[model samples]
Target: MPDTPGDAHQSLRDLVYVQLRERIIEGEYPAGRRLVERELAETMNVSRVPVREAMQRLEQEGFLTVQARRGAVVAEFGPAEAEHFFAVRESLEALAAQLAAQHATPAGLKSLERILTRTRKAAEAGRLRETVSLNADFHRAIVELSGNPLLQDMMAPLDGRLRRLFRLTSGPESTSPMCTEHEQLLAAIRSRDPQAAADLARRHVAGTRAFALSALGS
Candidate 1:
């Protein structure tokens, strides 16, 4: 069957959703910044219909909040929200690390090692953004290595929020410490020590939570 207008717009909607989500997560569209449908449509050379659909999807994902006056504004993370996020994150991360230790194969371990190698290089090069992105990749990789489809499914939705949180806490001073913690966690997984891996994961999340809360003045 020939593609209809709806089919075309669906593809455009996904593209717009991805682009807007990336911008929001990267802090280009800071919290409280209103996103105008018409403006974005014009900028991206797309129709308002697709832009609107993309915004609605982002809103469902907690990256944007729509209001009567504000239309769509980037979501903010306050103390309460931060606490709730960290609570869930710590649990999931600990579980992922433990499972990864139990299930990781030699190939899976090597994949994580590659991510760590790139992360270390990025940190050493003083590439803050790349380092932060690699940090998120490392965590996601560990989750994948858990070998449980259910656990992977659970972590999927939080990818964007996790990246945002990482961006918030990342800095020149953070790169080294983050690299060290990741290295230790990976080593635990390599050693097939589920308890050690889980403990390291919990501590890692706890450390990031404290830093995020302190920076947020929470």
Candidate 2:
């Protein structure tokens, strides 16, 4: 059902949203870049209505800042915002690792393995965008394995921002270390070592934060 044709009918606004968001996150539309509805509409070969809707949604999601006459510009997060985001990630991801270690079933572990395998392959193939998405999914799989609905909901929004940050800084070397850490973290979870898993998760998040902050010039 999820892959059905009915489910594939993404609206023009949704399509515009995805393209614009990707551009912003990838720095194709860098910080403070003005988002002109007419220009975007013409470039995307779409109507202004969808581009306007996409801009509104992106503004609400902190990817764009709308002004009275200046229209919308790409949003920029300063050091404080970066620090706050990383702190939130550190705590919640640690909790996720702990819960996953304590609650992961055989099937869940298998799913995590699948995600990790795909992630490694994407990284090795030089698919940075795919690797970023898979990296988020890999983390999401572990968080979902925690068997906590609230925790899953809490992580959903954060994953997008995490992807943007990860894509900005993570290169080939970063991918290898990240994959190695994920492998060791999965091993800890499989062994049911809650403390080890949680510690490793926190460390991973901290490392990402450090890289993100440095890359942002914060």
Candidate 3:
């Protein structure tokens, strides 16, 4: 049987979902930005069916909200929410770092160092947006290196949320601090020190939470 639109809807929907999700997480669709199906479909060069499906998924993911008159808009959270969210993220990612240290592979460490190199370049160029993305990539590499499926699943959503928060407060002052922290964290992991890696990861994430809160004037 030939493939039909119905059969492809799921695939198309997933593709559309990822694109929209990336845009939202990267701050392209900032908080309260109205997401119009027509606009998104046109922008993505696709029909509204997949766009609508993706938007619904995004709403379910806490990245969007269906309002009375606003339709779908990017979700926003309060300062307290930010604090709580990062606190949980910090805890989980610290666990990831600990596991990564225990299971650190040469290839995994090499991949992390490559990401760190790119992050440094992005930061040196003073591109906060790109830096935020690279920073996300760096931490994501670490989390994935941990090889824990549960940790991977839990940190998935927080990754997007963290990217959004990082973009908000990822200033020049934030750049060098994180670069240094990344080095320490990497060194601990490389040295096979799980406790040290966990401690560094926690402090690093805690510092980011503080930076974000201060940026929010909290």
Candidate 4:
């Protein structure tokens, strides 16, 4: 086992990757912003090697574009790609929700209920970022409750992209609508209605997709 939690080597890479990724998602880097390796190395207080490695990894992960002489730049979202990603995510998340509804334990449902309460409060308090994070946590907990490791693996990458998109679309007014959708999703899952749960999950992602598309001017 790795000394550090959550895949040590990958965690190191992810630490750098997440900071850079969040910067891009938060619009600090913006689209087509040039990434300077040495500058980032200095700012992050790490060697250029890790920065370069992180940049290459991010590029492979679709958050950046690597140019021969120009180095790396933040990747721009094209409308078609965004739509396609969301469509696939909707299908996968709906399946996950259905499985969760079928398999959720009493304890799992209770935990989900608690998460919903916290998420609702976060949204009400206008903590958009925290609400977005809790939203991901709520969905991840459902996926874990499904007891399907393969399904969890399939959803992880898409979840990362969704987080980025959420950050992109985040505003004061965005939280309430999302909170309402989450409430509906939890209601279906708590009822143990797989079809309803699946439908609600799909609708939630679809709504987010529409919101992100509009925000991206797609």
Provide the overall lDDT of each model, using Cα atoms, as 2-decimal numbers: 0.91, 0.87, 0.87, 0.83
Clashes of each: 0, 0, 0, 0
* TM-scores, each model vs. reference: 0.93, 0.83, 0.90, 0.87
Candidate 2's displacement at residue 100, Å, is 2.0
Model 2 regions more than 4 Å off: 1-10, 124-127
lDDT of 1 by residue, 133-203 (tens): 99999999999999999999989879889898878767788889899999999999999999999999999
Model 3: residues with Cα > 4 Å off, grouped in runs: 1-7
Task: Name the Cα RMSD for model 1.
Answer: 2.0
lDDT of 2 by residue, 1-218 (tens): 24764443346678899999889887799877898999999999988988888888888777899877887998776566689889899999999999999999999999999999999999899898788888988898999999999999999877767777776667777787889989999999999999999999999988888777887783
Which residue window of length 10 is worst by lDDT in model 2? 1-10
lDDT of 3 by residue, 1-218 (tens): 22996768878888999999888776788889999999999999999999998999888778899999779999985587688888788889899999999997999999989888888888888978777888899899889989999889988877777877777667888998898899899999999999999999999988888888888775
Ranking the candidates on TM-score from highest down gives 1, 3, 4, 2
- RMSD of every candidate to native, in Å, equals 2.0, 3.5, 2.3, 3.0
Per-residue error (Å), model 3, residue 89: 0.4
Tens digits of per-residue lDDT, candidate 4, 128-209, equal 8888888878888989888799999887766666667777766777788887888888888888899999999998888888
Look at candidate 4 and give me any clashing residue pairs.
none
User: Which scores higher on TM-score, 1 or 2?
Assistant: 1
Best by lDDT: 1
Quality of model 2 by C-alpha lDDT: 0.87
